[model samples]
Target: MTNWYKSWEEFHTSLSKHQNQTHQLFRLRSSTSVSQRNKQEVHVYAWMTSQESGQGPANDFVQQVDTTRGSISRFGTKNVGTHNHSLGRRQFDNHPSNRRIDEPGLVELVRDLSSACSKAKLIMQHLRLKSGQYAQKQSLYVYAPIIAHTQSYLILGKQATLRDVHNLVAKLKAMRNGSASVEERLKARLREFCTQSGNTATVFIDDAKTAQTITLQSQQMRRFFKAFPEVMLVDATHNTNDAMFKLFSFMVHDVYRHGQYVQHSLMENESEECLRDAISAFKEFNPTWEETKVIIIGKDFGELALLEREFSQAKSFVPFSCKKKYLRTEMTKREYGGTNSLNTKRAEDSIDMMLKATTLDEYTIGLKCLFYLLDNVKLRAEDPVPHPKHTFLQYFMRNWGSCRQLWAAFGRAGIPHLGNNRRARDFMGYLKDILKSTMGLDECVDTLIFLQSVLRT
Candidate 1:
């Protein structure tokens, strides 16, 4: 079982003889060796089989060696041939338990009881309080161990922590959601919708890495477009889904003067190509898309241009409300000092007044007033220096001045826009109430279809 040497010379001779001949002797770390109360050193050493000695011991092996009196140390050797030393106590200690649930049956029972609850700590508390109730219903043998474990770790302060319960609950949730990817689930829901109704939906995969876009329109959407193809409002909302894709909503006015969503597309980005793909889907699903006479959009010039090119007969207009919002955003810049400057306020008022001009002549006069207010800033007697609104003035003249008719009232005076962008803005508020930022893509699709059904009512 064990080999003992009497003399230090005999132990050294055996250690030297066993080095490469039959076995290997290795000294354990000093921490493994302890001194007794009398101050006698008890060294720890390891002796491994010659076959595994060249590769070193697979695990730590400690043996109490008697170093008292130059007598040889008591050496203990494990038979590597008969028994495997690979699986030591450290192997069990190093096991991965991040996703492991110690009480899986308890987790499942709790999950079944509390499907709506998400807080792991609360669920644990409920379980601890009502363990007797569950034990009465289910097997007492099965729950007794659970109750004991819970009391030991949670109440009595043992090895387990609260984080352990949270991790186990998270693992349970992951398993409950199934193994399908989010995109696959989204596509499955779309396919199920198309099969249930005579609707159409298509997904455009840009590439493996880049985000994708899904364009969908129901049967009622087609009828809405055909009934009222004169005007349309195009806008986008973000953070509606976990994928961070922008949900582009194309709405139109119904007979009741209600803004109804006619088409929707979840896009990766609002690039021209992505918009074109969405519009192409719209045109394919609704033949009356080309009959749109008026389009109201945001401050995206590229989107405006694309809409013009796609619907050549349609006139696109960015309403005054949107223009005011854009201007106010620009006016808040630190570079322009602030909007309280006389020149900045005058310029803003003049622009607002200019956008309301009904005739070209009136617009021309309003433009002159705007320039005069910007150029002739009445400086206080204390400071005679020119106003620092040159940056804002230049920005306005370069961007807003160059595209006057697009945002001005006279641009689409001949066309009917109903309430212009008021209906669209209201719809955005409605969308915020229904959708959430943490929703998955499949959940977003389901919510969108539900909203469409509600609007149809």
Candidate 2:
């Protein structure tokens, strides 16, 4: 319920009631409280409970908080007592569903959902659109009813509120994903999908065993996996599905210069064995999987080392981001003037900025500037010219200088994307939204195939 204030003084007085409260999030805005307040006021958006924000009874919540003596915490007790008793429980509008079009919540819903629907992912979470019909709005009327039922409002007309749209989407997902047991529903869907899509998907599930893995690959992915087996990015993301299994993404770029997700695997963990089994399955899907030489890039050497064995000709590269981090860290040593002049922070920033340079000319200019700073510091002290023996330059040269081709933009042969955990992390945020990625085995399949479908178009 939203509480309102007539003037700043009133609002301040009410807020002061929670003076000793901490870590409570608050959002305030000017709202037309129409059917509720029908007066000029500021509103506090909150679910009414024992405490203003459900923090609980405060030890020292008075205007003049006394912490010296062991003061009894009676602050939230008043709210708690008030919350428990039904006397004047009208704090919540029992029949708020009868509110008019000008109601505060409905108004807020309309305002927020309009902006949210502009984004495809958000709209998908909030709407009930079927596959291939994501863009089509055949029955806006159907979505409106979802709002009416959830909010207890009789939606009379064609005009739909943002709240209605979002609720409808949620309702649709609950239905489409179905209420079948996680395993049974998933197995059925997997069977139907494999039959329909002409794609290859594999699942490993065992009640007796602790961990499971599911892998999905499309026809486009199959072709790319077989033809140009070069440059695969391997990374795992967590918490995108219902189960807490790690969602590992195997990515490669196709001839068309687009970043393609060739395989999606859900594993119990990122263990070397799990990864090895997952990668080996690529060959199972197509015997010619490792027919061509491959280049594998990843953050984990444990996994990459195993790939070396499977594909002998496969070259391994570290993500450029990881290499940059290592350089930045190594320079932050005490000998490098940790926080003294020629500081590590500045050195690290310079190196990072220089590495991101896309062209050789830009990189050369950046390198010149970097050496000028490092060299100047050395000459100013008349210190023996910097050498590889003790300085960061030595470690850098030995570890990464010669390998610039593996991490620098100019060195990449038109490869547009690097396989990094960041990409998977970002996608997980969008996939999970407020719900888990997969609820069961079937839900896991649905989630991966949905991702594959999105990537396809």
Candidate 3:
């Protein structure tokens, strides 16, 4: 039976009446939703249980269907193990059986006599790795709670040390199946994304001989794209998974006037063809893409060139970091690679002026500094040894210098200095911390979607 009450008093009275009449025990828990903006939501969960007067911690539970050898067993703790001595129960209440500070590994003769391998193997999850436990005392510097855990779950005597359990884990791993697969799993997850996002989510996964591309977007992402189609930032991160896949993200400014990266794609490489597939999918989803300004704040100018060719209508943005790197590299070579002449001295000081330029007036002064350093007459009589010249500067002036409107903030009237797509990098770090390890393709997508939903709600 279920009922909804408007007031807490009313609900409490009704719940008390049921408890008095049925004499059933119940537990109360809450789920909290906290936003990055510090907004909070709390949901109260109160339910009945058949465990009245149970002799254990209220939340500590072991889901055991049977004592079968290979049956699934879960020793779950509600909140990372809280201590409640008055209740005579605690989470993970396992203590080492050995009283000594040092113990030797089992000899071959003793190992032959031991027969608790199956029971011990049932406890450890990670391959040959023991769980880090809190040490309780100084005398038992070498004692492990994992041995106690194995004993509690399998009801075994003191027959296996930590090493014995690890050996068993290694043995079982050799006989186990290969790494888990994920194609079908990701497809199922994408289906769920579509439902949760009211069919606004878009997903496309294709496997080719040379490349694999998986693109995903949620309602929030689409909404951002629809609203702010004027500016788009594209970037890719490498070594994000075991398959050596690169994760790419597309971002736009949100209504709050903040950067919101709204899409993720896994690709085999940052090649033009691979990136084109991902960008075209997003471009097709939103009709206003042609009005958008595309920024490629990633490595590889070839990728940027491909984007320029693919979306010629959108204005391109070159990140300030790349501009600084090019300026510093070529100018430093001119300053230090040649003699201590007046030209080299002037070049050394000019590099400082260009880097610190802020406004249009200041930027012009910096350009004058570069012009002086780039003058071929100033760098005359270069050393016999390898030295800096105007070659790198000349190439840049003929090609990139003409595109100041794309790379220089001073050229854009109202636009602030859009340094790099750092928000995407920060969000990626948060996701990595959440998973704490390299996750499968399906699992990674599912986790990101869940995080998006949390932020949305």
Candidate 4:
């Protein structure tokens, strides 16, 4: 029967009395602590077995007291075995099959493996391999004692599983990164670059609102800018780091006719002020920046206006391919043909002809053809709801038509773009090859500089 004791001492006194009277042994199974009325109480469990019995041992006597409700419970167990619950017995008398490493070096090996984020099974295999025990049966066998030791070494206070190792690695990585602020880390990396390359790169650190920007241009880049400043390409990449900052690159064609990055800026956004600051850095470092004659870019309108204001002499050229992609996206909008594939293709083909026109006369004819096709478009009986073709026509007129001379082929006929205006697009693929999606700004800067050094040589 279960009884509630006022203290742990009282419970032990009563338990000893039962053991002496019945000549029984108690093996502690486990214990659980509960808080009741702002006070902590523990419930201890022990299974009883008779040492020398005339009748069978009372294995069915189970008592559990719920301290919260001040209630008692009793249950029966069918099996009971002799168990030595003494701490000394547990320390010396383990199963013969259980493995333990007594060598100091081997024990430290387990700790090293665990610290290196090895899984329990893998660590066991490595240990077994070192001991020349390569049996297939031991492949999945994990030594519990080594794992317990590893847990202690890692300060985990419990058995170390695969997830625990992963958490440890993640914690260490976070601690390493947290040792310095973002700005400090970036400045250190820049300093390392300067020490190695012997080039005093331009850097801008803004501590206001955490929208700090860094513009990098080495001395070699300055020489390239002065010699080959006829063509320039500017583009920005997103999701480069956790801060959501955009990386903008200003490139120029080197003497070898290869697109080489002259300047790179990591900014908080594409705001005009940030762009102006980056451009000003460029103009400050390389005096021949105004000598740039042709600037090729994607469809960043804000960048276009800023570039126009800063480098008015340079002709801003957007590739026809970029315009085609944008126009095709607009064609799929609801006000246009929506999901009507046939109408979309027809509109796209006519627009492609207009954009591919070599002269103003050919452009006009292609435009008339587009208008004619839009006017004559008919909806199929099985098709979904049709949209007004005039919507796309109006959109083109309002957005692209007003700036036809900027993106159209006829207007860019005489401009020298080194046979293409997609230099920025080509460089994007190279950047993606060297950069990962999860790199921080400091790592990104280091990687870019390392690769640039390799390319510069």
Best by lDDT: 1
- Estimate the TM-score of every prediction: 0.62, 0.51, 0.52, 0.61
> Over the stretch 159-251, how does candidate 2's per-residue lDDT look in tens digits?
323554545445545665566666667677878778855587776655775447777788878777676565566666677565778877776
**Every model: Cα RMSD to truth:** 15.0, 16.1, 25.8, 15.4
Clash count per candidate: 1, 8, 0, 0
TM-score of 4: 0.61
lDDT of 3 by residue, 196-233 (tens): 63334444445543337777777677787888877777
Candidate 3 or 4, higher lDDT?
4
List, residue by residue over 1-457, the lDDT tens digit for candidate 1: 7999999799778887776464455773444434452244212223344335665554434445456654544444544556443444333333354222344455676677434433556665555545444445554443122335645532211122356656665566567669988777787899898995669988887657554678889889888889999999988888887788788989888888888888899998888888998988888878777788888887754577788889998887887887887887787778776756546566678777778877766666666665456666553434333433467777877887777777777766676877467788799888876676656778788889988888777
TM-score of 3: 0.52
User: Number of clashes in model 4?
Assistant: 0
* Candidate-wise lDDT, in order: 0.70, 0.58, 0.56, 0.68
Cα miss at 425, model 2 (Å)?
Answer: 8.4
Extract clashing residue pairs from model 1: 6-72
- Ranking the candidates on lDDT from highest down gives 1, 4, 2, 3
Error of 4 at 336 (Å): 1.3
Q: What lDDT is obtained when candidate 1 is compared to the true structure?
A: 0.70
